[model samples]
Target chain A: MIEIFDLEKRYGFTYAIRDINLKIETGEFIGLIGPNGSGKTTLLKLLFGYCRPTHGHIRINGQPPSPKTNSFITFYPEIDSLYGNMRVFRLIDWYSRFFTDWNKETEKKLIEFFNIPLNKYVRQLSKGFRARLKLLLSLSRDADIFLLDEPLSGIDPASRDKIVSAILREYRENQTIIFSTHIVSEAETLFERTIFLMDGSVILDGKSDDLREKYGKSIDTIFREEMYA
Target chain B: MNTMEFERDRPIFLQIKSAVKERIVRREIKKELPTIRGLAVELGVNPNTVARAYRELETEGIIGSRVGKGTWVIPEALQEIRKEMIEDIIDKFLNNLHSIGLDSKEIKEILEGINDRDI
Candidate 1:
């Protein structure tokens, strides 16, 4: 379980996120949803320990986020951080050597499913393929928690479907996944719980089905009509 | 299995339940239901949602599962599903008419005015 208490982050004079408290249980698939500049990425960065919270704290399985806790968490950043000059197959080899829990079988399956060109350099691949390679690398690890930041952003609809399918295919029953995305319509069905962030604060947090029952609308509709309105 | 497009206004589990019930009624799913994970993947939904739908169906005696054997439609599920479907249709029809300002009296009058020979 992960417990975040009264978390706050600030950059210079501006607050990125403030007064955030969340408790994520094991095996739960959560959506961190918000528009641009709503601190979705900041919140994910804080969770992954890429940056420290200015106030409050986060505990993963009763331990704080650190290099030790990092082993249990697999983070897929929103940016393209792969080695630009390395061939796809070489990059995969280098990445697999870093983790003892890497599953070669999953790597093979994702490579086939995503149709990634192994001979092409990472910089030479299309945006969609780059995103697929990032996802493949993150999902190939056997980690307890997966933090994916906007895995569907800027991709075509067909590639988005393939990404969603790959995510589902690699989903283990015991793993916890918290993915942040504004593409709520396509991904709404995958979220068991959804947290709606607006202006760096959580405006809504509940089970997806309960939210649907309460509002009589899908999460996407609520996100658009209520949160953005 | 074909991808199912969900209506955005209702709870997804309820929608899934109705869809599965419709399939069972239509004999498209005669013997066994797909595994929760399989159905989840096919529908692009969380497996927990599919599991909830299955659990509700089980509670209603529409489906059953054993340890070794997979989940299957109950023998009398067809009759039970038909009764539920009829109730649902009537409830929806009544609600729709009511929403349009028609009371039970007007509904009954309209029903009585329909010519039997129109068939």
Candidate 2:
């Protein structure tokens, strides 16, 4: 389980997120949703220990977020920071060697599923393929918690479908996944629980089915009508 | 696996339940229902939603499952499902008629007129 207590993050007197508290259980699939500049990325960065919280704290399985805790967590950043000049196959080889728990079978399957061109250099691939490569690298690890930041952003509809399918295919029953995305309509069904973030604060958090039952609307519709409106 | 289209104004598990019932009534699911995980993946939904639908179906005696075997439609599920669907249609029909200011006498007259036409 992961616990957050009165978490806050500030940069130069501006608050990115504040008064945040959440408890994520094992094996739950959660969606962190908000529009751009809502601090979705900042919250994810804090959870992964990319930056320290200015106040409060987070605990993962009774331990604070650190290099030791990070070993069991896999983070897929929204940015493309892979080596631009490296060939895909060579990059995979070099990347896989860093993780002791990397699964070669999963790597092979995702490569085919994403239809990634192994001969192409990272700089030569399209935006969709680059996103797929990042997802592949993150998901190939046997991590207990996967923090995916906008895995579907800026991709074509067909490629988005493929990416969603690959995520489902690799989902283990015991793994906990928290993926942040604003494209709620395309990915709402995958979330068992959803947290709606607005202006750096959580406005809604509940089981997806319960929310649907109460509002008589899909999560996408709820986000639009309640959050955006 | 084909992704199922869902309505935007209903709980997904309820939609899944009706989808399974329609399939059973149509004989598309003759013997065994797909495993919850398999259907969840096929429908692009969470496994818990599918499990809840299956649980409701079991409670309603529409389907049954065993440990080694899989979930299957009950022997009398077709007739029961048909009856339930008829009830739903009748309820909607009555509600629509009531909303349009038609009473039982007027509804009976309309039914009689249709029977007489027989065209």
| Candidate that scores best on lDDT | 1
lDDT of 2 at A150: 96
The TM-scores, one per candidate, come to 0.91, 0.92
Residue range B1-119, candidate 1, lDDT tens digits: 35689886678899899899999988999999998888888999888888899999999999999877999999787998898899989999889999999999999987787765484
Task: Give lDDT for model 2.
Answer: 0.90
RMSD of each: 2.8, 2.2
Clash pairs detected, candidate 2: none
| Chain A of model 1 scored by TM-score | 0.98
Against the native complex, each candidate's DockQ, computed on alpha carbons, is 0.70, 0.61
Off by over 4 Å in 1: B90-119
What does candidate 1's lDDT look like per residue over A189-228, in tens digits? Answer: 9998999999899999998999999998889999998776
lDDT of 2 at A124: 96
Worst 10 residues of 1 chain B by lDDT: B110-119
